[model samples]
Target: MMKKYTIENNYIKLVTIDYGAAIHQLITKDKNGNDVNVVISFEDLESYKHNPTYLGASVGRFAGRINKDGYTINGKHYSVYTKNDVHLHGGKEGFSFKTWKMESISEGENPSIKFSYSSNDMEEGYPGNLQVSVTYTIVENQLSIVFDATTDQDTIVNLTNHNYYNLSGEGSILDHELLINAESILTKDSDAIPTGKYTSVANTYFDFREKREIGSTYEFKGIDDTYVLKENNPLATIYSKKTGIEMVVTSNQPGVVIYTPETMDENKISNKPLGKYPSICFETEKFSDGPNQKDFPSTLLKKGDIYKNETYLTFNIK
Candidate 1:
């Protein structure tokens, strides 16, 4: 059965549902004291059930793409489900399609909710029985997401929330200012798989070291690149002059995928006719295709070991 949960603090409100452990809505106040939903969402549970765009879902067993042939661990190769020659977002029916169990909920100064799921052995061509949990917490103007998991056997894992943001609460994100604390990004092949190469962002269209309008770059094809994050505390920052809202992202992960799709299914969006470049997703997680790239950080999680990734999003008017 599908269930919804809501938790909020003085400065922000968060609503989530057990279906996919997805975020339904996140609301913050603008400079004019108006409520603004920075992320896109659907109108009903049916739309979420067929969430083709991923929307505000928590994605996993692996968050990014994997080569179609799959990866080898402990000298044994494991094949995964794929489409169009790419194993994406943890196969066809990944965590985003599952109904997670609500483990707990707390309401106080810092309200929070915890959801858990158990993946059976070999489900979706993955090895081992994995146990996972995602916790969402709100304190003041900040929201924190914590992902924890453990597997019975050695396996790969990369989890992240797929929340498309439009700080203005409507229209495209072309005018939003973005800044990424990274010097290089992973180069990809035609199939969107990392090519084991790091390209410098200096003087390039991918450069976001300085806060600048997303559309300032001419002929912007849209960003679907993974940035190798520096040791900076906040990995990225986004601001919208239209609403005077700023979002600061900080994560313990080593990489982040900034995705700005050229278009979306407007019919699925609630009370809005969103068009091209409507929102941007900051997927804070390990490098894409890390399992296939020898130089990239490993996504291997051994038995008896715990895998943890924590990311914080702080919002304010500036």
Candidate 2:
């Protein structure tokens, strides 16, 4: 018996888990008053198990990269689990793949599902017995995600939900326009690890200071740049010139990694016309590669401290 929470408003609907994957689908009318499933989903556990890219899964333990999978914490060196010669998204078997304990915070009227998990000391090669909770709520046209955590020992923690979206609920989003309210970005090496340099978004393809078509320069390869946002405001807009719909992202996280399905090789559910580049992901969270880089923001959770973060995705039309 898998758990699913279905939420809707006048123009759209978002579905998530009584577990973790945020299978958000925008249910809207297509020219006619005909309702269609414009969103994508693996929906079942079997698909999520085989899809190494996480499909529409949440990212955690750590959401991005760590240098050499080795780093020092409080004058002591800790070697985290490795991937591509580095540590990516926690480690080998991070929390995203696990089933969280779920509880309904309210019985009716915009209810939310709370997911809690505990990571014991040195679990996945990191320190601390961290207890974390993430709540998902849908009210009006907004899908809000709230994350909280507490730990008994010092350890690095970064969490973010990875959901791909296409505002028009249409075909490839390569022509969709985007605007990021960021002034700078953390530079990275070819392997996508930060080079310890924070540079301006000026005159570079890194600039999304204004609306730009995702396809205009997409041939230069996909963007996974970590933008140093204006504030803890992790909001950006994607407007589908094809449909008049716009999707807005708001978060307390300091950075966002906007990515298209440039690396997608997964199957789309039949009856839907989805190409490889249909959707885009807005991964909102703390700076990437923090554990190894002293210059990056610290993600250490002190003993008895509360970690709280909020990210909301709202929808509307132009």
Candidate 3:
């Protein structure tokens, strides 16, 4: 069974569900003082259950792709669930399809809800019994997601939320201005798997160091690259001139995967069909295929050790 939980402050209203511990809605006032939902979401639980795009779900165990060869720790090789020469987002079922337990909820100036799940040993072909918790807290106009986990055996973890945001609340995101405080991005092969190398964004279309429209580049297709973040506090910012809503994204992770799909299958939001490039996602997590890349930041979670990732999205009316 699935359940929804809501928390609000003076500036925003948020809705979350136990299935996938997903974010269902985030409503904020626009410049016109009218309500708008900044995140793309479905209208019912049935649609979410078939969420091929991941939607506002929490993806985990390993958030991104791992080479089809799998990974090793302490000289022991482990095979993971994979398809088409890659292991993605834990596995076919992954954390996004799990039903988490609602642990707690609170109401106040800063309301919050916590959801937990325990992954069994070798579930999805990953070793160890892992205990994971995701807490969503609303403080004023900002929403903070904190992911914490512990494994009873040596395992790997990279958890993150997959929320598609459209600050204007409707239409394509090409008109949105974007900025990312990063100088380089992970180089990937034809299969979209990182090749353990970094490419400078200078003199390239991948550069977002300065605020600019996402469609400024010629023949703009879409973005699905991982950016190596700098030490800047706020990792990225995006704004919609139409609604005068701006979002500042901050996180403690080493990198962020920015994805802008060219099109989505027929999915409805607010009784309207979601069209092409309706939103963008900033997935803050450790480097992709970290366990396989020796130089990338490790995603290894040793026994008895805790793993934590925190990300914040602060909204304001510009």
Candidate 4:
């Protein structure tokens, strides 16, 4: 039988994976601090094939774009294929788009669904035979994701999830209050690429030093940018000012990419309500090309090495 989990009691419609790292559910709420089912999804395997948005999908091989389709490492330039003039999330056939092998159990401390995959040498222009395992765990109102990866050759990798959250359990997150622990903002050149320079968030749209409404900031017009997370801290949070709901995002990674989904042309995804700024993603990962950038941390691994990345999302309503 396929592996799955349930927390059903007229509150949630929970589904797990015996295939990959995707959780399906409809989260509604009641007065007694309980969440109910409100999001519709396919009850069986057939419906998932067409589900785009990767909706709640586990992404990897690299979670963001690689500018100009390539980067250099150790004085060597490695070229990548251009998708729509730029390299997109793992070159179109990334892990998110694949059906992964899975394993499960019901009575563990924190029940989990593990998805494992391997990328051969030069897959997506990256070098290595990477063995990746993404495990999702839900415990005491918090969802913790642990990513374990090992590569036989040197390669670049970043992984994250694309989960749309509405603390109000409503449409759109424009009215949400977000606080990013950032002192200076990353200055980007054209094409939204980081310029390897920084600017103070003070007196600018990038400032989130205080708890401010996200939409209240004018620079939030659907532009996706990266922020080098403030050091000395392990987590950042966003709380809904109206519903009193809070989401804390914690990661061990060095940077976070805040993507206001409105940046994508709606038509590009077809006529669906899914294409707007209804959500924001705080993707935690290493700096893009950190291996090549003289100032950024090096992302290199030789054989017999182990690498790990972790992120946590905790939710509560006040």
Question: Please, what is the whole-model Cα lDDT of each candidate in the order they appear?
Answer: 0.90, 0.72, 0.90, 0.64
For residue 150, what is the lDDT in candidate 3? 98
Off by over 4 Å in 3: 271-275
The residue pairs in collision within model 2 are none
Predicted structure 2: lDDT: 0.72
Q: For all candidates, what are the clash counts?
A: 0, 0, 0, 2
Query: How many backbone overlaps does candidate 3 show?
Result: 0
TM-score of 1: 0.97
Ranking by TM-score: 1, 3, 2, 4
Question: 21-124 in candidate 2: lDDT tens per residue?
Answer: 44545465444445655455664546665556665666778888887747778888888778678788878878777767775555345756677888889988
Candidate 4 local lDDT, residue 313: 72
Best candidate according to lDDT? 1
TM-score of each: 0.97, 0.89, 0.97, 0.82
- Report the C-alpha lDDT of model 3 over 202-291, residue by residue, as the tens digit: 877778899999888745678889999995479999999999999999999999999998876544565244556878999999988899
lDDT of 1 at 264: 80
Q: List the residue pairs that clash in candidate 1.
A: none
Q: After superposition, how far is residue 139 of candidate 4 from its true place, in Å?
A: 2.2
Could you report the Cα RMSD, in angstroms, for every candidate shown?
1.1, 2.5, 1.2, 4.1
